[model samples]
Target: MNNLGFFKNPTQITYGMGAANQLREIIDAQGFKNVLIITDGGIVKTGLIDQLTRQLDGIHYAIFDETKPNPTVTNCDDAMLALKQINADVVVAMGGGSSIDVAKAVCLLATNGGSIAGYEGIDTCSNDLLPLVAIPTTAGTASEVTTFTVITDEERQYKLTVGGIRLAPKWALVDPLVTKSLPSHITASTGLDALVHALESYTSKMATPISKTLAREAIRKISSHLRQAVYNGDNMVARDNMLMGSLLAGLAFNNTRLGNCHALSHPVSAIYGVPHGVANSVLIPHVMEFNSLAVPELFSDIAEDMGENLESLTLMDRAVAAVDAVKKLSKDIGIPTTFAEFKVDDSQIDRMAKDAMLSGNIAANPRITTYEDVVALYRKSIGGALVEVV
Candidate 1:
């Protein structure tokens, strides 16, 4: 129905259990020497790092396993220094979102000759980054397949989204088995994170028929499989479904972009050190309730997809039901109900709201929101925020 459009996905993706074992072959195909592997300390403890090293043994790699949970510009700088010291020609991201983000920033800075901050808004970088391969250990934060990276600035106390197509990995290896060992809390949190991605993408202003298709399917998969996956870590079927859900949600948001939920969630994560998915879970339902009127049909569609009854319910009721479904899911998975539970203070609301407004995700919100909206949302999302919002 539309004439003009553009789609940008540069990563060559390989997804499955045991897929990471092909690292040597993937690296050989890329034809690069002197690679840098980026990951977090937790992954280093998981023995996957040893497997990765074994697969690519004697293949010229320097490990920089310091990608903190909320990766910062300082983290990237440190990784960059390490990469430069070793003269790495390729970057291998070997963990979840934080590791992938660090690798992306380092890869760009290696050739671009500047800090990660220099490439903040959009496709401002003209140079291509070093060939990078992403191995995601979590079923959430599909950072491996997307062009966006969130980096916190400690001095400024703001989480900024650094985006550019050049930041997309040259290859993405999504192996479900890597996620099997994640704790139940982590599985639940990341599963909710994937749900937020799907919901946000579905409600984004950039939503197209194609993106909606992916988003709806992602939502279905997460809703169906998340509880089982969280409860039974050994269930390969549940893990696989969660991974697929995460990947499809990544595909949807990568193209359609996200909205105000992500906008508000980023500040919470960056400032209070809340887990990324937990933060998103806290804000998503609030933002959804706020924006429900702006896009009722989309929300209604989501309600139907979540198996909520809409036969007698009005559009507003359906939207409310959708919000309730998200809240229920969060509760079932043991996600804390509010910012106060995360030890965030009431006085910090203004600072959080101010920073949230600066997130690029706000631009894609279906409804226009200002600082006031963000503040009110934060206020409503403190201890026991869910009941208050509903």
Candidate 2:
């Protein structure tokens, strides 16, 4: 309940069928002679990289496809080297969050000149990044529109945030047509990731009126359209809604930050190589349940946004219904089903919980989360079928 009446989104958002093609115009306006395209192997396989590069008729461009799923510190440094080799005057990140995150780090390092480790916490960068263009291929992470980049510090087994307005992309080109080729599982997991972003932001203690409105709409759009997006990747309407939902969620969370769900998920993915979205899916319901104790009315609002039938229910019942709705949604769309398949041991829970406790998101969580609370949540998330737990 932040009463300060503030909102900020510095990225110039461009969305439509051929938004990726708009990159040429953006680069031209910036008068950038050389362009560095940061992406992953998957995008190269999809031929999306080829499609976009073909549009860059006058600009010299090079592709660096070395980005990883987690976007490690090494990956950032590698991308930075690639940027230097090509002397790319502008950077275009043409994939999911991983690609965009790597691009962000590369841009930061190109000008900032230091280890990505030094800028871990927030607003630590002394200089503005190189001109960055984020073209999102997926609706999740919304790295296209965020000022923050999460680079994994593999040595420490932690996900580090390099934040502040300095990292915001100069342009965000969100094209639904580009997401048409996404595999079903990727669509499902990423859609859920967007939902968690909106939900956590909506229920955050730092949430402002503007963020709540954006988050509420994001929740509604994501909840209604996620199944369709997952089941029928050909549906353009569903893709539009999902990508818009992700954009809205990103805007919401960027201002409010996230909550215990994100805080807890970071450690799981950082430690076990679980997909960030899958890790978030496993922890979100339990985190929601924990936070519902503090804000049942807000949960009721979320339940309504999620299309739960709350006609004759008390606030608490509706709050509980929100959790149930999320669980059912995950089950229906084939998410939360992966956590059981991942290798996580009970012996590791304590250490993971300790890592979870270090997250700054804990402070913004709707509930005041403790170290013990994180441990209990991890065990609860693992209770059904998580393997190798003593």
lDDT of each: 0.86, 0.90
| Candidate 1 local Cα displacement, residue 13, angstroms | 0.8
Residue-by-residue lDDT tens digits, candidate 1, 55-85: 7766888899888989999999999999988
Worst 10 residues of 2 by lDDT: 381-390
lDDT of 2 by residue, 263-311 (tens): 8898888888999999988888889999999999999999999999999
Which portions of model 2 show Cα errors greater than 4 Å? 384-390
Error of 1 at 114 (Å): 2.5
TM-score quality measure for candidate 1: 0.95
Residue pairs in candidate 1 whose N, alpha carbon or C atoms collide under 3 angstroms = none
Q: How accurate is candidate 1 locally (lDDT)?
A: 0.86
Q: Candidate 2, overall lDDT?
A: 0.90
